[model samples]
Target chain A: MNVLEIRGLSVDYLSAGGTVHAVDDVSLDLRRGEILGLAGESGSGKSTLAHAIGRLLRPPAMITAGSVVYHRKDEQVDVLKLAPKALRAFRWKELAVVFQSAMNSLNPVMAVGAQIDDVLRIHEPDMSRKARGERVVELLRRVGISADRRKSYPHELSGGMRQRAAIAIALALNPEVIVMDEPTTALDVVVQRDILHEIRTLKDEYGFAVIFITHDLSLLMEISDRIAIMYAGRVVETGTAKELHRSPRHPYTLGLLRSFPKLRGPREDLLGIPGTPPDLRDLPPGCAFHPRCQSAFDDCGRVSPRLLPGPHGEVACLLNENTGVEVQA
Target chain B: MRFLARRLGFYLLTAWAAVTLNFLIPRMMPGDPVDLLVARLKGNVDPAAIEAMKQAFGISDANLWVQYVDYLGNLFNGELGRSITFFPTEVTTIITGALPWTVGLVGVATLISYLLGTLLGVLAAWKRGSWLDGVLPVSTFMHAVPYFWVALALVFVFGVTLRWFPVSRAYGLDVVPAWDGPFVSSVLYHAALPAITIVIASMADRILGMRNVMVTTLGEDYVVMAEAKGLTSRRVMWAYAARNAILPNITSFALSLGFVVGGSVLTEIVFSYPGIGSMLLKAVENEDFPLMQGIFLVISLAVLVANFLADLAYVVLDPRTRQEA
Candidate 1:
């Protein structure tokens, strides 16, 4: 069963000059106990999508239109429509997000343990202090941090450890889905591997789903059951990790896969994407990716394409239609 | 603990330097305190009385270094010499008599302004588009107006015209100054206008200061994380945002507390209140070197003490400050 059902969600950053279309008409699903990898380049709105899921977008960056239905057991609630009181309960209880750059995620003044304990105390007001204290230690240990490190502030811990502490806080209330936005980007490769391993082990043990958002496609390929490629604030492709890797349909996804050098393959120079992502404030008339696409035609510049169903998954490029490989969904 | 000792040592050095400046500046000026005293006496005093007056005021043929030693010795012994402004009265005695009223009235008034302003500023920043934004312009106006204008306006409106409060003095003319209720009420009644003036004039800086900082910290990642953690708005505001934002304000607050020893001179003068401020003015006007030096010493020491206290508070408030401790 799907834990989170997101449909046609759009986020716009309203500024003095003009509105920046950050996230536009994106829809996805997170099944129970599965890692759904959200892959994109830097300005592809990966973090925006994650923030939108929790309704954590601040002023300027507003949800122009969207509906995020969080399903738990038999109950369903549109996260966007929750009242302030219900919204407070909805966050960290049903959906917790570990933000990008862990150095800034946790409060610098508060102790690591105190920050973790905050989530528990707020969500479970009637939980005893002793019980909360014990849970903090357990959570810390679960994330591969020593119990003694609890008293240390965010600065006191290593970068990887700080990220782990953030995860521990997210895992405090045992939420059904955890949205991790570049949670391991700040750490070294070895530490990142360790954290990803810990996350997988914990997910296996707890059976909680994870929406992992990152620009690192290789890491996503290693961990994700299914992968969604976002381009210019919209998901351009969606497929299983192996299927997308072996035979990616989207041209943008193909360029991304080609950008990363394979360890075992014959030596070949990397071909990074030709141009930067489009200006979010003033996007192209039809297809945002057409200017950079090698296969762009007259029709490609005049019309946007929807994600059409295929054998592996779906692709939004009109090439699939021209080739007569798949029909529109 | 080491950091505390280090800080304490630094303050002691500053305190010594302040005391030396206090002792030197008054003497460096052209006129002598003995001359001022003799002029006050109107030539009636004899040469012998003049010598005695000079001796009482610590004027002697001793070299500057020896006199400095003597002054330091007198300070260590807690004897601040006689006040020329209030002749025959010990400077220490005069300060002791005046300090309680200043501390009780101006100190508490300034504190109230800080607390109320900071609270309102936090609310204003938290509710950016709410009616609390209306409080911002008023804070700016209060900040812009001169302290004395507010004091005089309040005195005219609340005291002279309205006849709601006493026109002058720290207490009623008929009420005995004591630890009793009637005397205390009279003191508070008289202080109301001056206190309101002080608050109105000063609270703006704090409100503006705190609001600017709160606006900045409210956008910090930690505050967002706190909110995402399902914590209440109050906890997110005070604990995560306001707590951090208040750090800079706390330093200024401590400095203001130190300035409380100097008292609100203009306000005190306008209200004719019995406080250190009026005495300080009188001392300056009379060129009462001993009293001026004494008041200056107290103010400097209070400032040093306040800075030390602020350092202690920072160590408690920000965990990073304890790194060297």
Candidate 2:
């Protein structure tokens, strides 16, 4: 069963120039107890989509049209319809977020332990202070941080430790879904690997689903159960990690996969996708990726493609139109 | 500990410089205090008696270096010399008499303005583009008005038109200043207009400054993290954003507090309030060198002390600074 379902979600940023379609008509599902990797480059709207789902977007960015339904065992909640009071309760307890700069996300003035305790104080107000302190210790331990280090401020801890503390805070209430937006991006490779491994272990132990958003497709391939490739505010492809890795159906997905170097496979020159992501305010007429797509045909620039299911998963491209596969609406 | 010692050393150096400047400024002026005294007495006195009076007032012709040494020696001994305007009365006594009125009136008013302004600033920033933000222009306009103008306006409106508060003096003439309720109430009642003027004139800067700092602080990732933690809006604002935003305002408040001893000169003059500001103005007008030096000394020392306290506060409030020190 799907833990969170997003339908036709469109987020627009009302800037001085014009309305920038940051996240346009994107739909996807996060299944229970699974890691759904959202892979994209910078400015691909992956983070924007995550923020919109969590209702954390500030001014200039608004959810123009979307429906985020969080499915639970006994009830379903239309997340967009929640009142301010309910929204506060709904966040962290039902859906928590680990931001991109998780290292800097912890309050600098506050100790890590107190920050975790704060979450407990808000969500589980009935819990005694002693109990909250104990829970903080447990949460810290689960994230591979020593209890003694809890008194340290954010700057006192190393980059990796701060990220762990952030994860600990996210897990303070044991939310069913955790949306980690590039949680390990700022850390070194070794620390990133350790954090990713720790996250996978915790997910297995706690039975909570994760929507991991990052631009590193290789890291996602190593950890995610399923992967979705976002290009210029739209998911160009979605498939099982193994399937996407072995044979990516979308050209954009193939380009992303080729961008990263393989350790053991036949060595080839790294081929980065040409041109930058299109400006959201003034995108191309059709197929936002067509400007950079190498295999673009005559019709690719004139006709936009719907997400059609090919043999592997779903692909949004004119090339997949004649593949004799049913389109998944 | 070494950091604190270093900071103390810095303040001591600053105080020395300030005292030296205070001593030099009055001496640098063209006219002698004795000449002004003689001018006040007219040409009727004998030259010998005038010379005797000059020596008595410690304004006798001597080497500049010898006079400087005497000035420092008298300062160390806590003898501020005799005031030329109020002859035979020591400068210390005159200043001390007026010090309390200024400290009580301006000090309380400044503290009130800082607190109220900071609170409103946090609110305005937290709810940007709200009604509070809309009112900011009016506050800024009030702040831009001249201090004396505001004082006069308050006096005209509250004291003259409404006939509510006393337009002049620190207290009613009938009531002698005492620890008793009636005397204190009368003093406070008279101080109301002047206090309100100072608060109104000063509050705008605090509000605008704090709001600017808060608007920037609200964009910090930790504040967003706090909000994402599902903390209430109030906690996120006061505990997270305001806590950090208030650091800059504390320094400004300390500087303003230091100026409290100096008092609001224009406001005091307009109200005819017996504060240090009015006393200082009288000393300047009368060319009372000792009195002028004493008042400037008090203001400079207060400023130095306030800055030192602000440094100490920064060390306590910001862990980042603590680590650096």
Q: Pick the candidate with the highest TM-score.
A: 1
lDDT value, candidate 1, whole model: 0.88
lDDT of 1 by residue, B62-107 (tens): 8888989989999999889999878889999999888888988888
Clashing pairs in 2: none
Q: What are the lDDT figures for the candidates, one per model?
A: 0.88, 0.88
Worst 10 residues of 1 chain B by lDDT: B22-31
DockQ values of all predictions: 0.74, 0.69
TM-score (all chains, Cα) for each model: 0.96, 0.95
Candidate 2, A1-329: lDDT as tens digits: 99999999999999999999999999999999999999999999999999888888888789999799999899999898899999899899989999888656887788899999988998998999899989999999999899998888888888998899999999999999999999998999999989999999999998899999999998899999999999889999999999998878788888888899875679978887999989989999879999998888778788898998777778898878855432221
Off by over 4 Å in 2: A323-329, B28-31, B39-52, B59-70
Model 1, position A5: C-alpha lDDT score: 93
